[model samples]
Target: MVAVGYTLMCEQAGPKQLVDYAVRAEDAGFGLAVVSDHYYPWLESQGHSPYAWSLLGAVAQATSRIDLMTMVTCPTRRYHPAVVAQKAATMGLLSDGRFTLGLGSGENLNEHVVGAWPHVQERHEMLEEALQIIRPLLDGETLTYSGDHFEVPEAYLWDRPERPVPIALAASGPSSVDLAGEYADALINTEPDPHVIDLFDSAGGAGKPRYGQVAICYGPDEEQCRKIAHEQFRWFGLGWKVNADLPGPESFDSASSFVREEDVADSIPCGPDLEAHVAAFKRFVDAGFTHVAVVQVGDETQPRFLDWARDEFLPRLRQL
Candidate 1:
């Protein structure tokens, strides 16, 4: 059976609310919770972005059983790979071995805050170099390294989980899929694309876990749900190519201004209809995702959504 997970949505909620929701999600019986690591919300209207690592520490202390992940963090810019490795190790110890570090090449929206963002190919190269430093340290190694894009004069992780934290790599293309297969313990993606899964397996991730995410807006009223999804998440409708290159929330706001409610409603499973939500998730399962995270779009709708998930959606989704 595919494991169902919840999105922590750091971009939409403050640290306290994230911790509270994580506790509720565990109570709601979600087996996993993926939190985004962003310096800025995709749009200003989304209204928040607390440091993800700090929020995760609180999440670790607050929840007992649910697995926690970064969703995806970029170690190439703004953070050194050594720091990310240290953070991941500390998180693993704090969460009692339930933390998974998810890494990606990153987007300009966040990375650009420090300096000019590198091109897509160079970004991937930087990520590969970072993994070289991160993977060994998580395995409890002390190292001094020099690479094309990064340098670690000397670094070591003194505190680490008995078992190395599992690493999941986010991939949406051939290059990234190859990287995930060669280095990651698991795979992560936003789409239900079987072709990517096949590529990942053939490239060296055959037995690794595959995680997928699907956005949904669940509410008593369909129209309200549609409105909420479009208003907060229309930036997604612009697609990753555009989404990754944009410099800020204002850029996203302008780029996605053309997105209509119907467009978001068409793609995301909207409203309280059980079957619609089920079918949306089934696509990822059908495409062979081992874990499918339900990204609930609106922050205000979380309490109601969590209640409904515990009472209804999860049980039905498990059957698929």
Candidate 2:
């Protein structure tokens, strides 16, 4: 059976509210939960970006059953890999082995705040090095390493779970997918494309859990849903290449100025159609994703969406 999960969008929700949402998601029957780690909201109108690690710590205490993970944290620049290993290790213990560390090469919007922006290839190289440093530390090993991209001098995680936290690497292309196959316990992708699954499996990710995220809006009014999705998430239409390069909200706003309601509607399922929501997720299942995270687009509609998910959506999805 495919594992259904809920997305706790930290960029769109406050810390306490996000913690509460995790509890609600567990009650709603979601087996896993993923949260975005962002320094700033994609669009200022969306209006929030709390510290993801701190919020996750609270979530670990608040929820008992649901699995938690970072949809993707960039351990390359804004924070060092050693720091990420430490934090993730603590989280694993706090959640009693329920935490997974999802990592990516990162984007300028979040990693640029520290005032250095490397080229795309350089970032990927940095990510590989970061993973090398993180993996051993999570296994409770002390390590010293000097790499072209990173340096560590006798670093070790003082507190760790009995087992190493699972690492899920985010991939949007073949190169990253291959990296994930070689290094990660799982693979995470935003799109529901079978080609991605094919590439991952061919590159040695066969039998590993493939994770995906689907964005949608749930409400009674279609027009309102379209408007909300367009306002809050149109930045997503820019594609990863552009999304990774853009430095801030202003750049995203300028880039998405031409985005219309139709564009948003086409990308994210909207309104009260139960089949639309199920179909949106089915795309991932069809693509061979073993785990999927559904992100409800608007903050105001979260409670209603969760209620509907528990009562309507999840039950039907499980049968699929």
Candidate 3:
């Protein structure tokens, strides 16, 4: 069976909040911890985007059994892949070999904080060059190279992990997906749709497992949950005029004109209900997602999230 896990979108509140959540997640019966890795938030107005690697280091020292990962780490534009490899290797050591490296081509909005904007195609091209260097460096091999996109002469990891760390790549388009199968051990994606998984596999990941995450809100009241989810994810439904463009949650902008404020109610799960969550998760499972995570957050759910997981969601989900 694919073991159930707890995925944390770290609150960046403080030390106590971070420690307490990691502990509670472990106690709540999670077999894995998928954390987000980002240099900055999508919108500074949203809140703080704590340094993810620093937090992951703290998490490593705090927990023992739960497998740790940066749900997905973006290696292009912001931090050098060499730096990421070093941090990831150290964390893997601290976690006693329980950590995995998750990678991606990344988004311009997040990456542009340090560098200039690049189109989607250019971003993927950079990512390709990044992985080529990152994977070898992490393996603790001496490097000597000069490439159009990147270069390293006599560079290699000294404090590499106890064992080779598994590298997973995230991609949404055909070229990136094909490159993933050719160079990566696994795949990650925001949309947990199976069709995309099939596409990646056809390109190369024939025997690899795919991990995905979908957003949902849980609360004591269903209506309350929907309101919270819609406010956060309406951007997804907002982007495209047609619903088919987005089969998943995001802040998509739709409507030729001002969008009638989106109703989040249909987007997330709320209240003490179990049926809806079970049904919602099934969409991911049916799509061939072997490892899955539920993005459950918001003020109402964040503080008592573990309690809810232990008392509610897990009971219903484990049965499936």
The per-model lDDT (C-alpha) reads 0.94, 0.93, 0.69
Worst 10 residues of 1 by lDDT: 235-244
Residue-level lDDT of model 2, residues 30-80, one tens digit each, is 999998999989998888999999989988999899999999899998999
Candidates by TM-score, descending order: 1, 2, 3
The stretch of ten residues in a row with the least summed lDDT in candidate 3 is 243-252
Alpha carbon lDDT at 10, candidate 1: 88
* Residue 279 shift from truth in candidate 3, angstroms: 1.4
Between the candidate structures 2 and 3, which one is better when assessed by TM-score? 2
* TM-score, predicted candidate 3 vs. hidden true structure: 0.88
lDDT of 3 by residue, 1-320 (tens): 45566666653244456656777788887777888765443322234456678878888888888887887777766787777778888887889998888887665435657767566667677788888888887788777767676777668778877687878888766787898888888888767567779888898898886877766677777666666555444454442124212222222333312433245555555566678777777777877777777677563366676787888777777887
Which segments of candidate 3 are over 4 A away from where they belong? 11-16, 43-45, 236-263
* lDDT tens digits by residue: candidate 1, 1-320: 99999999989999999999999999999999999999999999999999999999999999889999999899999899999999999999999999999999889988998999999889989999999999999998888999989999999999999999999999988999999998899999999999999999998999899999999999999999999999999988787888889999999999988889999899998887999999999999999999999999999999999999999999998788
RMSD of each: 0.7, 0.8, 4.0
lDDT of candidate 1? Answer: 0.94
User: Candidate 2 regions off by >4 Å?
Assistant: none
Candidate 1's C-alpha runs over 4 A off are: none
What TM-score goes with each of the models?
A: 0.99, 0.98, 0.88
